[model samples]
Target chain A: MDVLRPSPSGVVAAEITIAEPMVRLRGVSKVYRSLRRNGTDVEALRPLDLNIARGEFVTIVGPSGCGKSTLLSLIAGLSPYTTGEIDIGGRPVAGPYTDLGIVFQKDLLLSWRTILDNVLIQAEVRGLDRRKAAARAAELLALVGLSGFEQFLPHELSGGMRQRVAICRALLHNPPLLLMDEPFAALDAITRDQLTLDFQRFWQRDRRTVVFITHNLVEAVFLGDRVIVMTPRPGGIAEILDIDLARPRNLAVRDTPDFARYTRRIHDLFIETGIIKAE
Target chain B: MSTRTRNHADAGHPGAIEGKPAGGLDKGEAPPMRRTRRRGAGRGFRRFYSVIATIVVLLIWEGGVRLFAVPALILPAPSVVFATLWERRDLYIAFSVPTTIEIVIGFFVAAVAGILLGILVSFSSFARSTFYPMLISSQLIPKVAIAPVFVIWFGTGLESKVFIAFLIAFFPIMISTMVGLQAIETDMVKLFKSMGASSTTTFIKLRLPAALPNIFAGMKIGMTLAVVGAIVAEFVAADRGLGYYLLYANGQLDSPGVFGAIMLLTVIGVILYYLVEWSQHLFMPSALIRAADLTQATM
Candidate 1:
């Protein structure tokens, strides 16, 4: 249990000394009060501490009941935490932490807006310079191979393409932190793999500190610098495994023994936690 | 295939009518291609069929009245109705102008007030609690019953008629707008917050555009109701307008005159409804197209 606890010391010693971690969660927890008068309160996440360094990608994996999403929400400051403190870029998060990008399972693009306009919404809302933001939006869309689709509406695009547009929307502002909640979960196997590959390239170009949540064990291992495996209900970190694989890994790396070993370890943890039953 | 065998096969099949091959060779075409072609042709065919069906009904009525020797007072022929409409065009047009004005003014006022109230109710819990139930109860009270009260209060002037129309038209708009504003996904709201959007920014950019489809739907319903409301108000008390004209014609036992006024009323109602629809198309073409696509997919 002591070894599983996430510590700043476990990260690359050189990077830690350079600057403070991008995100710091100290004994953060969430408890949702029941809407009904007599209904029981739900302890969605147990108190836990974590440190995410700059440019590092940390992926959280858990079963449906686990509060992995709750943790992400806490960091994003989209919801109020029940207890403990969360710091992003050394500032205490009071309301929504605006200097970050977030992507949910659904693309959530406005149906009326064109692809270019959709990506530019982050800029529009944030009050960034439109000309610069539009240029950045074009570049980001091109990065995700969505250059020609700028004029099309969201409904015209396929699900995967729309997700790609969403990614571009998220990245348009060039936020230091990117939080994704199962962004690829809705796509088909082939589309998911392609996105995973493209995502690596996107991450490599400008490595933002990312806290991604996913249910897929392989995706967790493949994407994370450190994979945070969470327990079901009152979700706390079960273990955080350092993904020792090289950067910019392709789909073929998923087939390698090293990747398999990491995924296998997470799978074994899920079974031990009774999230899965081999029998 | 034999009729008996075909009938036996189609007994439980939902698509039996549509799936039936028009000619023997139609079965050889790919099912998907055949279905697409049929859908494309079906739209034009349906429109043509509707026109033909309306003509047939009119023809039957005209022929039946002549054949059965029915009295003109009882049921005027289509020809007589149209002829009457043409003969008294000036009177009908004069009456219709006031009716049209009442509808237009009432509808516009209702739209503005309903939308504003919807926004208030959606944003403020206090407003929601206090006004939502009252709004529902107000809807329950028959507008017709209270219409005379409006006439008493505002008098038999245009105000009373406009007020009545405004009353009838606003409920659906307010309710639908409220529902539309509240229907946004929680995650989408969170995303907006994360972007550091102010509440006003969120309302204008996110909530307003998202709610347009529902708002337009409400407006369409309200437009038709507005026409009804104006006429009802005029029925209660009016010196002018189509409703007063209709009553005047009925009192004189001038059946053609009554029918002509009614024909004018129908024209006004249909034109107002289409005006609302056209505005929706202009404002949100993509939403309209998407709605069409969704209906197509379901079909």
Candidate 2:
């Protein structure tokens, strides 16, 4: 087990055992050229330099059209970057890497497949041991409080429950890195809070490098070890603030003075960057 | 539990004494869950009225024929049509068997070919650009105009009718398969790709299952067209089959025989259509099947 070192901000830090850099982006950038509608070039992401240590939970928060999702896609190797380099564990990302797992905004679970089969998709695609993966799938479903829903289809579950299933699928492969793009944005507040706490508990239990993108600052503060606040067009990092609060965090942690200070700092940055107007 | 039982146990209430105890209804009365006895009876009555309406029209035709003394060669009475159908039942059965075989074989061939081509076109821009336009444009030409050509090419046998049926039914299945395969949510494709899913795995696990409902819809349309194609080919050139028999009856001015053949052809088409519907229920996912059933119920 890696030993936990206190974060530099120093508020009784959780056991954040940062080891070697898991993700490295050296001046990476992306420019999307639209070919279908109008032949126009849109600079979705400016060149960025970011280093995420192994087992770090980083949340990216930005205004809409800030290309926060583009950043994730570039890292996941789902799409090619226009320039610069991205390496995971010192190896350059050439294409979709086997070491990464992704959760999208929607559950994207196959309606025809049962919950168990949907979770097993990762194993099927990766050519993993079917029996072992199925066992893990069951355990993960139980972890996410979805133990009894293995045979149900996607349409049968509520939105929050479906999102939990998607989360289970993302973790079933036990990838070193997990990329989530606003996975809980569509749920109601109560469900969102419940999932957030559940997520925090899981991350605490078994650490993995996570890059979670959200528009909600509260979520960013609640879940991330560091919140990377971003600017609007040609999205670039505006601020990177370390969330110094201790974990395992619950819904009650949000009411603390430290949590408020972190949220306020990000809120102020958003205003200064013209992402939101001060009222 | 005691409070609920006390209400039920009251002896003075006639509601408790009646056999139809719950909701205090009279004996033999319809329950609240039912569709209403009046409405159920009304639907049955409407169906009975439809049959009665058809009989009345037949009676009027029979009466008009006798009263005006219309030529028997020109128009046959209902009785004459029934009598002719009964007398030549063996002939109709014999010819219908071959036509039915042709339609079934043709439809199966079209389904297999259409789905394969659909998968090919969806995966490659080269295939899509090359075949999509040709498939769409083929529909514009009159199928009947090519029926005789099919006879010349494949000869005046089962091959000709099968070829004609396949041609007519092929387009709908092809177009529908293409549409179905492409109808997936973009995120779904991205999801599979991100998981390092191979093209084959993505196709078999994701694209194919998602396309089933749309493919089934197209197949239903193609099935009806297959029946039409077979009959049309039979009309142009066939030694036997219902269409050929109908043409033979017409030549001899056997109006009742013509009607009988036409009625049998209609019956075959109806049976084939219902078969397609039944298969859709069998193959499609339960969620989609339930959705379709709900839509049908509401409509």
Candidate 3:
């Protein structure tokens, strides 16, 4: 386990010793009941327990219909879980958790707003100081190599650029927890690789806790401190493997034996669980 | 007969003009330089074709009328209609003023009332259940059929014409507004909720702006319909306006004057529709890009 470090705002070192996990899920499960289905229920997720320490980068990999997205929504308190306790920063999540950022597969950038204004929506919604948020937005956009594109509308940019703007919006508030659900799934292969690298660099800068959901095995291993492999339908954790990779890893690191080993382990798990067919 | 004409006017007139720029940008991923050049050439060609086609049609009408030696009482040539319009411009202008006022005021009232009622229907289940059905049933009644009733209730003043215009215009606007509000992506709403945004914040920032394109579409339809409604009301009972002028000219067997009045009404309808389209561009410049992207995605 990585040692808990004092927050940059200068908390006493002694307090770090007793720092609680940023997120805690105990026996969390979801069953979707439809009246139109004659009261039949669909179990989306099974009861599961997990802990994510502050500043940890956790990625979840699963097959389609494995409740990967449901888990993310559960953690975000965006949906009601049928059973279990979910705690974020030691507080029980009752409703939509405000002190976090979420990115979905779609960029969801407002069509009418400029890229700068899209990022500023976070501040506008949160009622943050405009000048400070604008400065921060500019910095985040620059970090994503989108400095010159701020005044452009969402459609003027490529799919990859739009997702980058989405990332900037999510990070604008500088939330302690970031939840991403297949954010780069819509991008091309090369753009996806570049964004994965860019995302890792972004994470390194602030080291916020991220629960990234993806179906891509390589991405789970490449970006995560630990990758949680999940079972198909009624999803429960199959395995949680620590990546044990060094910081500031590049795309080149993806070709390394360690990276391959992590990805292979995940791939093997999927095959064993019948999510992948050998035939 | 009036209902048929209104339906034809509402169907696809403004859409053709507004859809051009959007179609140009449909290939969003295409190389910018190549795309812009192609778009410019394509748009220019289309405009050229449109003008040529219109001229050809007019010329054919003029030639056919002269060749057939068609009775002037039966059909006035386009040139004759133009001459009649120019010679009596002051009279046409005087009559058009009242009709324009009726359409404008009625359309303004409809837009305000329609948008507010749409918001109410979308937000409140009670309003939806109670008013939505009535609104739908109201549309089923041919608005032209009720023009006489409006005349009886409001008398033969601007009020009757304005009321008829509002009645015709409000339905499309209200329905479009409702659809726009409800069409918001579920995930987008969830994002707003996760941000701790209040209902008002969500409605104002997300719902309203996202709904603008749709609202503008409704407004375009409504503006044209308002013109129809005012004219129809004048047809029922009015001493002035283009509809009354057409009737008067017909009574005198002045086919040229009648054709001239019809031409002026066409001008008013086209201008009003384009005005709504222009406001949409003013309010939401990215609407075209969004529309283009949608087409591309569907394709």
TM-score of chain A of each: 0.93, 0.92, 0.92
- B295 in model 2: Cα distance from truth in Å? 5.0
Candidate 2 per-residue C-alpha lDDT over B1-299 given as tens digits, one digit per residue, 9 for 90 to 100: 00000111121223322343234221222222222233544766786886699789989999999889887788888788888888988998998999899999899888888888888888889987997788778889998997788888899999999988998897788888889899989778888888888888888778887888778778888999999889899999999999899899999888888988887888898898879877774555544465556675797
The alpha-carbon RMSD values of the candidates against the true structure, listed in the order shown, are: 10.2, 9.9, 7.7
Candidate 2 lDDT, tens digit per residue, A1-279?
234434333333323234467898988989988887877899999999998877788999998899999899889888899999999998999997767788888999877667888899889888899999999999998887776567656765678878888988988888888899999999778778878887888777666789999999999999998899999889999999988776788888889999999999988998999888889
lDDT of 2 at A124: 83
> Which portions of model 2 miss their true places by more than 4 Å?
A1-19, A34-40, B1-84, B250-255, B281-283, B292-299
| DockQ winner between candidates 2 and 3 | 3
TM-score of each prediction: 0.88, 0.83, 0.88
Please list the residue runs of candidate 3 whose C-alpha ends up more than 4 Å from where it truly belongs after superposition. A1-19, A36-38, B1-34, B37-56, B286-299
Docking class of 1: incorrect
Q: Give the native contact fraction of candidate 1.
A: 0.43
State the C-alpha lDDT per candidate. 0.83, 0.81, 0.83
Q: Which is the better candidate, 2 or 3, if ranked by TM-score? A: 3
